[model samples]
Target: MHEVLIVGGGTVGLSAAVFLAHHGVRSLVVEREPGPQVHPRATGVGSRTMEILREMGLADAVNAVAVDMKGISLGKVTVETLAGADFTTMSPSAQVYRDPDFTPARMRGTCPQNRLDGVLLGAARERGATVSYGTELVSFEQDDDGVTAVLAGAGGTRTVRARYLVAADGVRGAVRDALGIGLSGPGVLGPGINNVLFRADLRHVIGETRFAVCSVTTPEAPGTIVTIDGEKEWVFHTNADPAHARDVIRAAVGDPGLEVEIVSVLPWRVRAQIADRFSAGRVFLVGDAAHAVPPLGAFGMNTGVADAHNLAWKLAYVLRGEAGPALLSTYDEERRPVGALAMEQALLRLADPRLHWDNDPAMAAERARAGVVNAPVVQLGYRYGQAVQDLPSAEDVALDLDGSVGSRVPHMWVADGVSSLDLVESRFTVLAGAEDTAWASAGARLIDGWPYGPLLVRPDGFVAWRGTTPDDLPGVLSRLLHTA
Candidate 1:
């Protein structure tokens, strides 16, 4: 029997496998499709996701494959056509330019979904994860001990048993339906969008000036053009039919003579909803299976990656006998709220992409009073467990890290060319001041500050406790891990 079985081999599921492998836990990822999708789905990867990738030792690899669209892809630009005169650009909010000290990780980059998936799949396999494509989960049943699942594929049907099961099969997957889970929140947000992938050379027309997203408002075939490589590879999103794909591309580019080759057209819908629960019995849901949010802020994939990161370590500890089984329940308790919050934020962005960046003092003040925060806060400022109770009534627009419980530890330079974040490993670490000699024997990562107390940092890099005395350290650990 496998220790863990993951359904769906998209970015989120593959990320879960990689994270689990980083913790020395192996998993089997079953994807229905024979291979990764060629067309790009998501183009933006946030800072938090990059940090997690750094922790998994794939940061360099991802950077090599990702395109740096930082300054080039600033905001949305509306143009008459690719080679038109009239242009309207929406200035991005000041919140987009975050403080350099916000994190020790590198800046976020843009990589087509297929490229990112390849990176994750390579890393997961290298780290001892088994990924089987062309496989489908026919049925599954979970009990207290484990889960028994029947999977079908080209080979035939096979029964596999796993200690735990994760559903990453997407928004309309069968596992969630089999579990009888229901969705909550506003359903569909917008009209059906057709992703039209094509090859074209617009370099001569736009030259060095390139916008991240170009909204072509051509009368015949209005659509949005997203740069995949900032060159020939591009994706045009519209509600046009696939039969007239060439016409749509030509009209959007405003160049009837421009040679265009349509590659693929995929239809998708924008949705804002989350599962009523994230888990059932020993089975859990991750990514689109748990929450389906609009892609306005590119929060859907990022949130799913975060869900995998949050649950991977806890599952590792429990499987290793270091934490109690009850600790697993915290996966839902912690991730559900974050999923809901991401859904809410996605909807807000859908309605107004620059809602959090309102310049008016009165509007900003009202938004602040209502606890409206920007992307950084949603990405890095979120907390888990008992730490939620300590959140302020209104969150700041910047990333919040004060060594607080349930929050990620603040990034600080620990040694030459090494960040405090680099010191976090696959075990519970005590971040103590140099003066605190007690934790020295405990193999703590001693750093400045907290001379009056020590911080217990979990394997996932969240602060589990902050206290002055080490006398009750074991008790605190017991409570947090539910090992007692």
Candidate 2:
């Protein structure tokens, strides 16, 4: 029997395998498609996602190929044409990612989903994960002990048993439907949009003004142009027919004479919906399977990656006999709210992009009233209410990781190049303030001026507890893990 059986080979499932393997857990990833798609989708990878990649030692590999958007505004700009003079930045001061001190890891990296999938798949395999393509989960049944899943592939139909099953099978996948999971919030937010992928020499048109997203507002060609390579390859998202792709491309480029070749066109719907339940029995949903957010804030895949990271460590601990089975329940409790919050924020961005950078008191109040937050807050500032429900205040703002329970630990340099985040690994870690006999005897790693005093960090780099007494560590773990 496999330790885990992942139902999809997209970014989320691949990330789950990598994270699980990082903790010495083995998983099998099965995908219906033969391989990764050859197109640009989800070009943004946030700092939090990069931190998880850094923990797996894949930061250099990703940064090596990723396009650095440093100094470039994540806020979208409106232009009459790519070569036109009328260019307006919608959010002038919305640079939440501009601060380098937010994280010691890579701030943000832009890589096409196709390329990112290849990187993750390579790392997952290298770290002892089995990836089988042209195969898919046909059906699954779970009992108290384990899950039995039937898989179909080119070879034939085969049945496999796994201790746990993960469904990363996408929004339209059958796993969630078969499990009878319902979604909440708005289903479809906008009209069907066609992503026209084409090749054109836009170096002269773009010139020195490179942008992540440019809204061409020309009536003749109303669409959004996204830079895939900031060179020849680009994607034009438009409501026009696929037959008019070339015309739209020419109008948006403002260069009728430029040679343009249409590569592929994908039609997708902008949706904002989250599953009512993230897990059922031994099966858990991750990525699009759990929620579908609009592509406004690039939170779809990043949220899924966070879900996989949050679940992987708990599964490892349970399998290692360190934590009880109840620890698995926290996966849905911790990640569901985060996913819902990301979806809400993405919907807000879809309604108004200016909400991303508008952090004034009035705007903050509006956002708070709407039950939404800005990009940085959605990415990193979120607190797990289920983990820290007993605390008076559990929420932490962006870059304010003050060792609160259910919040990510603060990132500070402890060595010449190492960060305080490096102290966390595959197991529960304790970062003690001083070399006290009580702390040392209780297996606390002493560090000077740790700020949190006696801190207990979970396997996934989230704070489990922060208190002055060292003896409370065991009790905290028992309560948090339900391992009495």
Candidate 3:
């Protein structure tokens, strides 16, 4: 029996396996597809998600192949046509995440879903996680002990047992539907759009204003030209027919003279939804299974990756017998709200008039004055919430760690040329002050010379508890982590 069984080999499931492997937990990732798709579906990876990858020790491998789209200079320019009059440029996406001030270690990267899957699969396998392709989860039955599931693959049908199961089966989410879980909020956010993948020498046309998304406002072929390689390989998102993709590409690029070769076309719907429940007993939903946000601003995948990270540590400790089973319930408590919040924010961003070539000036001005920009804050600055209904908050005071108990610990430097984040990924730790405060709790590291006093930082980098002396450590762990 594997410690964790993950359904679907997309970014979320792969992430779950890698994260579990970081804690020496073995996972089996069963993917329905024969292999990874070479589709440039989700092109954006947020700064926060990058931080989590670094902790899992997959950052360098991922960053090696992940393209950073920051060099693309042109913002969203509202143009009448690909070759016609130009309108005001839309607000540029925030690059603050790349700056050292915002994050000490990680930066955002633009890698296609398929490429990301390969990277994650490599990392998981390298760390001893089994990823089986062309394997489908036929059915799973869960009891108070564990989950017994039947899997169908090329070889034949087989049975496996796992302590926990993660459902990352995507928006349609067969597992979620089978479990009779419901979704809340808007089902379909907008009309169905087609993504046409093609190749053309658009470098000359793009010039210095290389953009990730360029809006073509002409009635001939209204769509956004998305750069896949920050170059010629692109995806045209429009309402036009697939057969007319070549012409649509030429029209959007404003270059009838250039030859465009159509690669692949995908038609998909945009949805804004959050699952009513993230988990039912031992089966938990992650990524698109838990929430479905529009593809714009790259919120969907990043939020899903974060969901996997939040659940990975808790699941690992509980399965390892280091923490009580009560810790598993906190997974839903912590991540469900995040899914809802990301969905809501993604909807607002999708509705942002600035993203469109033509917009109501009055509404834009009001939103601008209201400081309605949440891309950075929503992506990175979000803190964790109360895990359980009666989780204590008395001595759970916020310290130097982001000024909140449930919030992530702020990134700082370590004495060994590593990051403070690098120090806490292995297990729960208590960093004491330089002045020698007695904070010796079992399984907690007592380090001196911290700028602040004693702080109980969790393996996930969130402040679990804090105190001045050793006496406060044990009770805090019992309450926050529910350690046995």
Candidate 4:
């Protein structure tokens, strides 16, 4: 029997497998598709996701295959097209938005989804995760002991028992339906979009403006042009029909002479919704299976990877007898609110500038405060405070981490090219000022002398608890371990 059985092998499923294996827990990832999709939508990988991958020793491998779009103009020209635009007309950064105070070790990047899937699929197997493509989960039953899943593949149908299951099966996947889960929130954010994958040489028309996303505001084919390879491969996401998508691309680019070949046509919906519950007994929903966010902020897979990172360590501790089963409860509690908060942000972005959307006052006010888009704050600042308890800090603004219990530990530099985050990579770590000896004197591998005052850090790099007074240290540690 497998310890963890993951259904759906997209970025979410494969990433869940990788994170689980990084914690020394083996997992099996099953995908319904025969192989990688021809065109995947997500392009931007936030810095925080890059940080988590780095901790798993995957930064080099993933970065090796990624396109560094940082500090490059994302959109261009008279307004949106990539023609006759000056350098100043270009945008700030390509992928990771740089933050002065809390910048991580990695910058954001863009990689083709199919190539990224290939990277993750290879990396997961290297880390001892079994990834089976062309496999489908027919049905599953869960009791107190474990979950028995019936999976279908080319060979035959087989029953596999697993202690836990993660549903990365996407928004409309069968596992969520089989579990009888329902979504809550505004259903679809906008009209259905058609992703028209095509190969075209745009060097002549692109000119000096470089971008991963170029908005073509032409009345005929008004949509966004996503650069998949920064070269030949591109995806035009528009409302136009596939039969006329090629013509739309030509209109958007303003170059009818450019050679374009439509590779695949995929219909997608922009949705902002969260599952009523993130879990059912031993089964948990990760990625789109739990929440559906519009692509405006590129929070789709990034949020799901955050879900996997938060859950993997907790599952590891429970399975290793280091923590109680109660630890698993934190997954749903912590992730659901973050998921909802992210959905709100996505909705806000999608709701903006569109006369068709109904703008709630609160959302409008928040949007006004967050004037122009600042991607870093949205990516690095969200907390899973709900994991132990749902505590969204109303007074807390984005982009600042002030030693809060449910927030990411403030970053700092250490000697030997180590980061403050490196301390909590594999297990629970106690972080204190460099001079503080109380934790060390107690014979714990005290990560002596850090910025924060006696913070209990979880394996996932979030602060579990903190107390400067140092009273009831053991009790506080015990409580946090049990609760988290």
Select the stronger candidate by TM-score from 2 and 3: 2
lDDT of 2 at 420: 72
What is the lDDT, from 0 to 100, of the residue 65 in candidate 4?
76
Residue ranges of candidate 2 with Cα displaced over 4 Å: 72-75, 86-99, 357-371, 386-400, 435-437
Residue-wise C-alpha lDDT for candidate 1, range 1-484, written one tens digit per residue: 9999999999999999999999889999999999887888888777788889888888788878876656554445667887773332445433333325657677544678888998999999999999999999998888878999999999999999999999999989788888999999988867899998999998766765555577788788898898788788899999988888888888888888888888988899988889999999899999999999887667889999999999999889889999999988999998998888888877766666546445445665555545455666677678875333246523451335777788887777777756677788757888888888888877777887543257888888888888667777889999999978
Q: Write the per-residue lDDT of candidate 3 for residues 64-119, one digit (tens) a residue.
A: 77656454444345566655643225444432224444444454446667777888
lDDT of 2: 0.81
Error at 354, model 2, angstroms? 0.9
What ranges in model 3 sit over 4 Å off? 69-72, 81-97, 353-373, 386-401, 414-417, 436-452
| Model 2 weakest 10-residue run by lDDT | 387-396
Residue-pair clashes, model 3:
2
Lowest-sum lDDT 10-residue window in model 3: 388-397
Q: How accurate locally, in lDDT, is each candidate?
A: 0.81, 0.81, 0.74, 0.75
Write model 4 residue lDDT over 399-461, tens digit each, in one string: 356568788887776656577788776677777775777667543344545556787778888
Rank order by TM-score, top first? 1, 2, 4, 3
Candidate 3: the clashing residue pairs are 433-449, 434-449
RMSD to truth, every model: 2.6, 2.8, 4.7, 4.1
Query: What's the lDDT for residue 361 in model 3?
Result: 47
Q: For model 2, name the residue pairs that clash.
A: none
